[model samples]
Target: MRQALERRRAAKAAQHLPHADLADVLAPSAVPEAPVREKGRRERPEPIPSRRGVAKPFSGRAPRIPNLPAFRSSTGQVQGLYPWLYGKSLPPVGAYMGVDCLTGGAFSCHPVEWLHRGLTSNPNLLITGVPGSGKSATIKGLALRLLTYGVKTFVLGDIKNEYAKVARALGVEPVELGPGLPTRLNPLDSGPLGQHLPTDPIELRDRLAEIHRRRITLLSSLLEVRLDRKLDPTEEAALAYAIKDISGEHDGNSQLVDPTIPDVWAVLRDPHPVMVEELRADSVKELRERIRPAADALGNMVQGSLSGLFDGPTTVRLDFNAPIQTVNLERMKGRGDETVAMTLACASNWGQTAIDDPNGPVRLVIRDELWRAMRIPAMVRKLDADLRLSRSNGTIEVLSTHRLSDFEAVGAAGSEEVAIAKGLISSCDVRICLAQDTAPLAMTRDAIGLTDTECQHIASWTGQHKGRGIWKIGRSSSHVVQMMLTPIEQELTWTNERMSL
Candidate 1:
């Protein structure tokens, strides 16, 4: 009993002892602290040990790395190496169009504005697409938007009267031309150019000569379009003599009298003795025979299906002060291409008067269905001249067509006319191509010099939405633009009212 009591006392004493700290209880064998080095001394880290079964990689000297020299080049040269390096945003100027779908940025463009800003080489633009692709709306939108910048629009030939509403919206009634229509355009009128002549004899003579030359050229072009053949040397000489004689008679009068086509017709019908001598003809009868074909071509304009249109002096005067002017040719739609082409030629000549005036306002000349004019080589030359003179006239020439094939359709595959037509396409720096069918895509691609990628994108836009097009500016800048319009624009530009019915 005494021994058991002693053992219990010992166990109680052990239980009452103080508890040891966690650090003291879990402490391992002691490790020596690292030695401190002197201020100037160097110390290296110890090497790591290898695993028992692992093999090490080769520890030889590393192969020498190449040290290449830096290359230097110009931005232009560098662009060839890295085309994307020059993909900068176009300057924010001119009309505020819409957004560039490719870059998700706003887009705005005007031919003349861009020209003044040095963004484009010329103030000529071409917009083409399949019908119902919103090309018309885009054109109207461009014209309406450009008005804010003080630029005016002149629709040289509105074949289907599509722009009549837009013209009316601008508070101007479009000039309507047809067989029975009272409106008459004198292909001979000197336009505003002949309104006032300078007092100096030299200047007066030059100005009068310019007027006479323009009339002669216009008469010849009209005849060529009607006859579908170029005038021979004799025909051209006789035509010039008749114009000069009429011009001389009119200039001698106390009152200024603008010569009419009837005057020209009468002279051709009866050859003057002086004109006969100038032509070295045997007699008046011989001169008449040489010019019979030319006379007949003019006679057609005087009495043929085009009778009463270009026969008289211009009945309706163009308002140069107006913001927009259009010649409505809707009545000529079913009259056949020959009649339409002749009328367009005459109208274009008449419109040239406005473009010739040095002091006239800068205008946007819209030629819709330009393919009609392209059908005739003479007309092609006339248009080419206008395009070349756009810079001097301070005008923006806008051409809209259904397809590029219209150019190829001008003449035979390799004819001069076809070549000129293609050159016309090349002259336009701003080419806006909307959605197109596969049939025309090949021609469009070749004519526009589009890449395969652009061709694919343009093909995909078909039947997707309206107003989407590839807006190629200058030589390098290109954008996939979605033209946005306001409610008023929607109403004015909508062409489906007939379809809705």
Candidate 2:
């Protein structure tokens, strides 16, 4: 046992020996030798001394913490409680919007770019806020910034000429349409579609039919806006007959010669015998009676409040190659909301046809004061159709209004028009909502599915600075983006110049 203890002590002492001394210490010799130290080499230090003069081992545990998987949440969910926890929700593509208040990173986005990236379902956008909450400024700044990327901006109906200055800055003149303006827009004008026709007979036939349907829909919408009600079955039939007769009279072999509003009005005024018999009318008088309301409404456009504008062929064609185009409807302000609504509807249809090319470059179509057009159910339907087609045409249509409740104002409570108008908001995947009064924001919150925190942010922004809004991307991503504008853009988007003066 004494020899075994001596060997164990030798093994422990050998651990502290130098390489040469290890062999000496392990060797079986009668005399024991101490560990040999190298010259100028310090010995190993002892364990850290304790205050009690006794070294204490590290007995503390790493606290029993459990590993957690990363949780995904929107800005609305986190209220930015954890900033910089995630990378950018969107890629750095398209226009430079501004700094992301949540991440302190620059936020840049465009509807078309996001759509191509599969970050958004559709390219359309819906902007809603109070009148002075920088809705127009956001649109103008983004539109101008997008010019660098070859995205064209077209204001379908600039009700207050808000985009006129932007167009001028882009070296393009806005088309002003109102009383005393020589500009005319034919609702039936075949736009880019007629300019380029398919060579195949089957394709050509389908295209022509599509054009016919569009024209009919436009005319029907105009009449409904004037009459203030949906057309009856007999009235719709009579109107369809009148449109067909006008088309047959002016249609060319290889091209569709669009019939003017006046031509359709004339046909309705004097019904052809075939039309009379097709409608089972006893005589032309009976057929005229069936279409008198529609005819009178059309007559108003040619001779009443809406005269000289849509009565003939389009005097000015839309230049799609231009960086920006705007239809100025400022003069229509005092003509009553109905006249303005009807006129805007026609102008919207005209502008749409001009940009409806499937192969055309990506265009940003802005519809300002969309609530006015929504007043007419037919116009609401037209907007719904546009939303559906935006995906195929690759057009990012920005629809701006004052409040979400404005959609409810389109028709009576629970009416089909109201449902369709609300559905329009649903079809848009990207919604930029600015500060709004708390009362209206309640409806907006429920309609947009905004989280409670997001709702508070938007409501509180009313007293905050301009251009501070919540940009909701897709279903989950929400960003508090402050839309920054350059000095030049500031001048272009400044709309309160008159008020400030």
Candidate 3:
């Protein structure tokens, strides 16, 4: 017992010294609890201690939340209380994506809220910012995400070549609209685009007008073929008389008795035997009372009330995708020079046809650089008010512009750049910034109204951050998503041949 007791004493004294304390380490004993930080007179964390006190810093321990995992198993309730998070990274989306120029990646705002406000609720959205403010990319980015939801897309590549890239990537053919060859896309064909056009009276009138114009143009062109020459005013009048003759043939196809009209000379010589026969002078008189002015007059009214028609999924594609700079608007005449006529007619016709097709896909209408078309008086506000309700019935539109002032022409405010800046951004639910100076776009450190931390990050941003953008999905600005990286080089395509966009 004496030897054992002495041995135990020696082990106790040498406990922390090499192997001397090995056997004594197994002894069961009460552990004294470490000091816990008690709340001070102030509940908030204390200010950083002075240099010397840094080591002791108030409580030589971190707050409960910081040391939580080490102290105990995670509380499921606490985990549940916080929002959904993917991993240990600063942000999950960023882990997958590295933005253009900033170490700061995508943010995770409330998606449900933004989705409710931007897509599910408000059908009309006006996105305005200075030229190159990333507006076009923003639209494409939003559409890219929406496509995952199985939404159909129709873009009127008016100016920039971006939307076409998105469409091509998704498998939509590129169609160019011209004098005798305007492409008519039915919602039945694609499901959604059809319902957009025929939404209102103005839209209806526009549709009928386009059809009428096509019919008239076809007749006129047929007359020219028959005549083998460009018809002069007198020849045109004679051709009209000739068409009237063709329309008069009862239960029979067009076989002209007198195809002497200059425009009809070609058909007279080499008639597509089944060619629609011309209406004679006498019969044409009565038909003129009905169909004569329908094309021109209806086409004119569509221009006047354009904004009132853009409410839903209706669309008006500007000629931005064409050889734009070569297009001399001044030299254009009759219906050819009139873009508003086209918008009105297209919207009216599509809406009238698709409104009742229950199984039809959602409607999508695209208008690129709309300002050029809206310049003719009343078209601006027509788009804004009409576009609001378009999406509920699966109607959507892509409206693009290079100048922010263009929004004023459409009613967001005025041609002033400031009108675009004041606050419309909240409505730009899925905002994107592609390769543009944030300062010009009202997204500078001081512009977005950020908290101190965000401000600190923004101050450090630079231009290599091209394609780094913002995306808000729901109605009340709910979900904010941060995209760390986008496949920028992959989006590159070889198509901008036009100079105007």
Candidate 4:
């Protein structure tokens, strides 16, 4: 009983002993204190071992990767990261137009080459911009550059004489025509026929018929512009017969004599015997009465204010051999629009003969402010025909105006004049449009088939954006460019600025 009591007392004493600490109870050694790290100096992290097997690629959702900080840069610098965000450089050929605002590369354009390469369907180019928008400068620069490549440039009617200085610099004297100018250009003058004259009787006959047709066309245009009305069918027939008679009478010993406006005027005033017989008129007076209006119109051009220019034979023949030729009409500034249109018609016909030289050097014919002539129906028809024939004749014609509405204003809505104007615009394969007033944006967009993007681009152009324009080539390709001019070119092409000063 005493031993059992002693065992119980020992067990109770063991249970009452103080509990040992956790480290003493669990750890085999004393835990060391972690060393404190210095400020701003991070402790190196322990390396983590790579997973034993390849982790399956994310299947359900993309793994989130922490995005880096955003960066800001100028366009010039950002372009390096995204090259395709800009326009591609064009084929390095033709004239150096300027820098492509989008791609920041040199932009050159060659109408003929572009056509040959199938880049454009037609070689003709149409440029439109308001006054002081650098249209003239661009054309002048193009002409100068083309001259270096042995291409000939012919400015049909420069009412402002804007091209005179450039023509002089090119070593070609400009043929200035106006009311006090001694220079006279006979519209009836036979122009340079590039092809050899035919010796065969049949061929000769056909050639002569073509010549007669051209002359009649020219005369009709002149009279229509002067009279501000279209010629009647009977009147046209009479005029045609008179021209044929006069031209036949001048043909002697197989040596052709060129007929002048005076000859046509005289024939109209007093109908030829053959014309009288053909018309079946009782007398010359009756014949004259029937065509009195036509006769009077011809007389005005012969004896009236325009007498010195067209009545006589051409005092100065166009030298197609020259690299460039300019017909300056600055003196015609004060003249009525009718007179200006008539002169333009005559000059264009005269220049056509030279431009039709297929075997000669490629020619670039520029008609600035074409709206001045489009006011006349006859002029519109002539321009339309010229645009269509430009490709066949190896000529690239550049037509420019302030707005496309100029074409719509050619005549009343739905008139033939309007249709002809529209046809001319449709024939162009390349179009360069500078900044324009808001008035004609809608018409311009519709007429040129501009897309919403292109419309917005053009609309954004302001006066501050000089030398900048939208070049639309083919059906959908377009680029914004800034025209760069050489020192000499800028001086030669500078206009209105002097007047403004």
Candidate 5:
């Protein structure tokens, strides 16, 4: 009973003050004191050896090392380590930087907090973990900390409506995401190109060429559909721009939505084609001029999607959770197909932009999946990983997928080089493996090679509790460490104050 009481008192003191010493936190108990010994019985202390030279670890014993020098406090003439503070040296272990969610208690964890704090030291961070391994919570904590530090937040979303409440609570409006999404969002379409676009003509041309080639087929498809209609000259030029590719985003990204493609599309999809004379493109020559403007218009729209994928002062949270309306090549193309294509263009564009701005302050650029846009393969596959490792952009990307082998879905039929499937995982700076049963194990093996080391790591990973995960900080290193997360308050999970001023 007496020992329990002492323990309770110490815990109470720890709750109120995070850095208090254990001895100081507990009060004296009213136990009978042991009788004092006689002077003659005094014993000399034995000398202890320095632990630095020790080879094998002494199991169950803390590693020994040379003690840090002691000091005295001049102010109070205190014979202690803290020469400036009545003094005593602070214990080496720093307090935990975690907040308890349920009780709203601030907890102290010594070594782990040291590592957690280390993440903020880098401009780019890639957090990968199984579903419950605290990845979401940690990012949230980082966001909350960043806000206090005045770092702007943006969530590039693939999952619909998930981040809306979180975004609103954090004082930023989430880019609205839902079904029947606007075929083109204007600010999203042109904003990035207007501001941070690369100035080098050669580089600009290359980027434009890369993007154009990837979507050329899709753009042309849209063009053929529109050539069936007749529209004004401006619209015709826009249509041409969309059908063929321009290397640079020379026109403002906003120019993509020519106010022509939709208008032309409206004519083609008109409820009464006889009533809408513009819907009548009776000859191939007439179709040729009219199609130019619609193509140019569609091209601008594609460029805009790229703009939305940036890591500027905003977070892009796209909802991928929606029922994707896959483009049916057999049926007529619709607005749904355009929206999906636009989403991919935005993802591809920002990913490339981040590559160009690798060391810039825009820390992380996350797009849920890189494979959904079919155009990426028959065309722009190189950009996906090239942009991933660019240090200057600090664009740490995240691809949220239920299957760990998202990369496997890509690759040419019967391609002997499995590297095509291995490419995405290989580029990631971090890989977090998570699952209840076999899914996570399978993902780890597929993403990284199914080597013996990863196999053992997965076996170990499966044993962890929720919110805990195996963290692989780099690809070349086989070493993986498990992390146990303390409860994190959703609202306080991400704070800007933790970032540099």
Candidate 6:
């Protein structure tokens, strides 16, 4: 009966199961019939089509794959692949200048440091922009910040008295020059050195020679501006002799004898007896005649409209120890361009003397509206020399002007004035350019050697990017930046003269 039961069960099982092929039945484990799943247990769910088809969820942590090797790359290549990851920062050891729009990093620049690092060959800066482009504001901001770090500033030719408030804020007075102002600056003031007198006989001789040369150059520039013509060769020679004779009279004294305009005028009017005797009659007559025009031109400065400011001994002195000193020419406004030019020439000469000390504090000499002064060939030449010698004197010259054409406008094409103007531009190793008009933009590009990218940036600048500028130092690529100013800086540098309008 048991055997009959087993046979029945086996027959039922065989009937229920499907027939298998010999190959499947012989396979290891025989494709073990899918194990019966537990009741109420979940089966694998169907994947819903993702909106972004086939994309996996991005996790903050990267998933690891078995047997995968690591990958390596260069920072530069990676930065190229992801542009926003690049950041080029300058040395962080200077006053905060602004923000580098490219990398969004703070941009700091110290002209002295740049010189040491060889990033800039010279410590001179040229700031160019159209009017209302915030060039002045940028310089003012830089000056105020530098003062906090003990850098002295000498603002020569404050055409609009823009730095007057700044000077006062720094606890120094601006030397105001005009028709009725009490302040007077003798372009010939020797400052603390008294015409740079030295104890050594040879040194004194050299110093005297230098002073005489500068005096002649300054007088020539003044007379040229007054006469509106370049001095002839004979006129220049006669003036040189006159300056030499007058300086000889002051040679014996160790104390600085301030040479006044009247003294120089006297020598020019009547050739010194010694000078006259040294020359033949015809030569004397010719010398006197040649110097007359120059003398008369100087006479205008001493006795004419320009009399009070430069005629006498310096009534005001440059306080070298003071944090700031400004030659305020605001009062000279409406007096005609000639008057302004002469005043600027004299003021700049006086400033040069003031900062001549080798042991003096490092200076930041700012020439705002620089074109007004640099238009004069002699002045521009002196400026170029100053820029070249700035390194020795621990000085940095910052020149700001409205347009590059200002240099071209100094004289006729191919004239010395133009050459001098170009020289001044070339002396600067650091250039800060702001918004410009169409014509100026093109001219600046040519003058400053701007690339196509830089040209586009300058051309597109507008009201919305008022304080933005391009800084090109040495041969490096240009940096686009927005001048960053503190609230106090903005208040001090506010130059929107039309804001009241």
lDDT to native, each model: 0.83, 0.84, 0.38, 0.81, 0.41, 0.79
Cα lDDT tens digits, model 4, 274-360, are 677887888888888989998898888788757667677778866778888988888777778877777788888877775666478
Clashes of each: 0, 0, 76, 0, 72, 0
Estimate TM-scores for all models.
Answer: 0.81, 0.82, 0.42, 0.81, 0.48, 0.81
**lDDT of model 6 at position 380:** 79
Query: Which segments of model 3 are wrong by more than 4 Å?
Result: 1-126, 129-133, 157-166, 180-358, 361-366, 376-378, 396-398, 410-463, 470-489, 492-501
- C-alpha RMSD values across all candidates: 12.9, 13.2, 17.0, 12.6, 18.3, 11.9
Residue 325 local lDDT, model 1: 93
Candidate 6 similarity to native, TM-score:
0.81
**Best model number under TM-score:** 2
lDDT tens string, model 5, 1-501?
999999999989878847656765586345668999888897668555445543456633445555799865554345334432211221234333343322234432222222354522222333445444555655444444444333333454344333444555644544442333332232222323333546677876665554444333334433433343334554544333432322223344523321223333333222232222333556545554544466454445434432332212323433222211111111112335434544454444433432333233433344433444422342224434343443434344444444454455544555422345455555554454433245556656655555554566455554244344333444332223233243445443333333647
Q: In terms of TM-score, which candidate is stronger, 5 or 6? A: 6
Q: On residues 1-501, what C-alpha lDDT tens digit does candidate 1 reach at each position?
A: 999999999899888856777786688356667877789977787666443322345643334545789999977799678865426557888898888876778888777767777778998999999999999999999999999988899998899788999999999999999878888887777766676777778887787787787788778877887777899999998888787677664345422456678888899999978889988999999999989999988887788857867788888867778999999988888888878888898888888775578887788889999988776677887788888888887788899999988888888899988888889887889999999998999888888888787888888885657999988888877788899999999999988888894
On TM-score, the stronger of 2 and 4 is 2
Answer with 1 or 5, whichever has the higher lDDT. 1
Which lDDT value does model 3 have at 11?
88
Highest lDDT model number: 2
Q: Which has the better lDDT: candidate 3, or candidate 6?
A: 6
What tens digits encode model 2's per-residue C-alpha lDDT throughout 7-64? 9999998889455655667794557688799999998887774434443356443435
- How much RMSD separates candidate 1 from the native structure? 12.9
Model 4 spans with C-alpha error above 4 angstroms: 1-87, 194-196, 226-228, 249-253
